[model samples]
Every structure is written in C-alpha cells, then in structure tokens.
Target: MKTLFLLLLVILFISGNKPGLSQDNNLQKNLGADNKVKIQSIIFNDIETGIVNNDVKKFSQYLSAQTYLSLINGVNGYYSSNQAYYILEDFFNTFKVVSFKIKETKTAESVSYGKGDYYFEKKGKREVAHLYVTLNKAGSKWYIAQISIN
Candidate 1:
C-alpha cells in the first residue's frame, strides 16, 4: 500500500509540473512574436520620420548591409549600407520633403510591407510619389530590405 501511495504522489507531481513547462513555452513564443511586431513598428516609424525630416542618418539605421533599391521605371540596383546612406544624403540634398504619410502596413512573421505617399518639393515644385517598402527582421532588429518608388 505504501509503494502504491508513493507512486501516486510521484505521478501527481510529474503531471502537475508539465503545465508549468507548457505555460512557459507559450509565454516565450508569445514574447518572441510580440518582439517581431515591435521591431517592425520601430523600423516603419524611423523610416517615415527620417524621410519627412530628411535625416539620412536615421534612415541608414534601418537599412541592412545588403539592401536593394528599385525604381518604378525598371531601374534596380543593389547597395551596401554605406552606399545607401550616401544615396539618401544626396536625395535629401536635392529635395525637401513637404509631407509624408503611411497609407497602409502589413506584417507577417518576420516580414513587413508598407505603402505610403510622399510629397516633396523639388526645384520649387511640389511632387507626390507613392512609396512601397519591405522590411525583414535581421537578428534582433528589423531592416529595410527593399524599396520601390512609383
């Protein structure tokens, strides 16, 4: 009778312990997912504000080393992070951003897509352009991997 009682206690303890493990695993998964979403949000916010303020340094922070820029009229180029930084610097020097707004955003796992409208003043004329961007999580932070202008 004592042996049976001890076995019952052991079984109860083991069974009781499993829910804690499951809960911990679930919590970890949720936390990781939430972190991905937060990273995406941060990347978008930085890019939008950077472009609006013509802050090339702020924009460079969210660009990966192997980022690619594609224009709507079939001009595609691959740029290192440093190249991208200089490109943005030149762009900011050329045009003044009048206003910028994000039209929509979609996120999935480690990827995010954003569409936006940008108003720029170039040579004293205001021009509007549609911007499409894709960002991916790289390590612990999100980086802009691709951008297209239309």
Candidate 2:
C-alpha cells in the first residue's frame, strides 16, 4: 500500500508539471502581443488619411529613419527618411490620390503589416494600385519601415 500511494503521488505531480510547462510556452508566445491593437489602428488610420489627402508631412511623421519605398514607375529602393519624404512628395504630385483604403491589417511579434488599394489620377487617366506597408515596433512607438505600391 505504501509503494502504491507513492507511485500515485508521483504520477499526479508529473501530470501537473507537464501542463504548466506547456502553458508557459504558450504564454511566452503571446507575450508582447497585447497593447499593439490600438497602436496599429491609429498608425494605419493616420497612413490612410495622409495618403488620401496627399500630406507628406503627416506621412513622414511615422517613417523610420531607414524607411524604404518601392513605387511602380517612380523611385524604388531603400531611402533615408528625408529622401523618402521627397520621393513621396513627388509621387503625390505626379498622381493625385482620389481614394486610399486599407483592406487588411495584421500584426506578428514586433512587426505590423497592411495592404490596401490606392486610386489616383495621373494626367487625366485614372489608375488603381495595390499598396503595402510594414511597420516595426520600437519601444512604445511604431514606425513605418517599408512601403510598396504596384
């Protein structure tokens, strides 16, 4: 009877420990994911507004120092913060934005990404382009790391 009771106790302890280890792994995976939802919303909303209104200053406010931009027919490459600002300014000048809408937004770990559609006019011709932007979180703030329009 003594040996049987010891075995039962050991089994129960092992079972409890297994679940705790698994739970800990899950908790670690989900850590740092909370509190990002609101930030992502605000940043994406600001981006949408800036594009729709062709406000380079407002858009530049969120750009990372190493921001990269790839446009369909214009500039394409990694650019410094100031260079990107001017490139965007030129793009906006060449194509007048009629509408900008975000279709999807996703966040993983320290990175947030979005996809949308850009409707604009260039030389009296309407054009539609797909837009993608990726943002990286630094401390308590998010910065636009890359942008693509095609």
lDDT (tens digit, per residue) of candidate 2 on 1-150: 999999999999988777553323433454465633356666787789888889987557778889989997777888888998999988988988989899999988799999999999988999999999999988766789999999
Give the per-residue lDDT of model 1 (tens digit) for 22-118.
3234334545634553556656776788888888676676778888887533547889989878876776667677998777999988899999987
**Candidate topping lDDT:** 2
TM-score leader: 2
Q: What clash pairs does model 2 have?
A: none
Q: Which ten residues in a row have the lowest lDDT in candidate 1?
A: 21-30
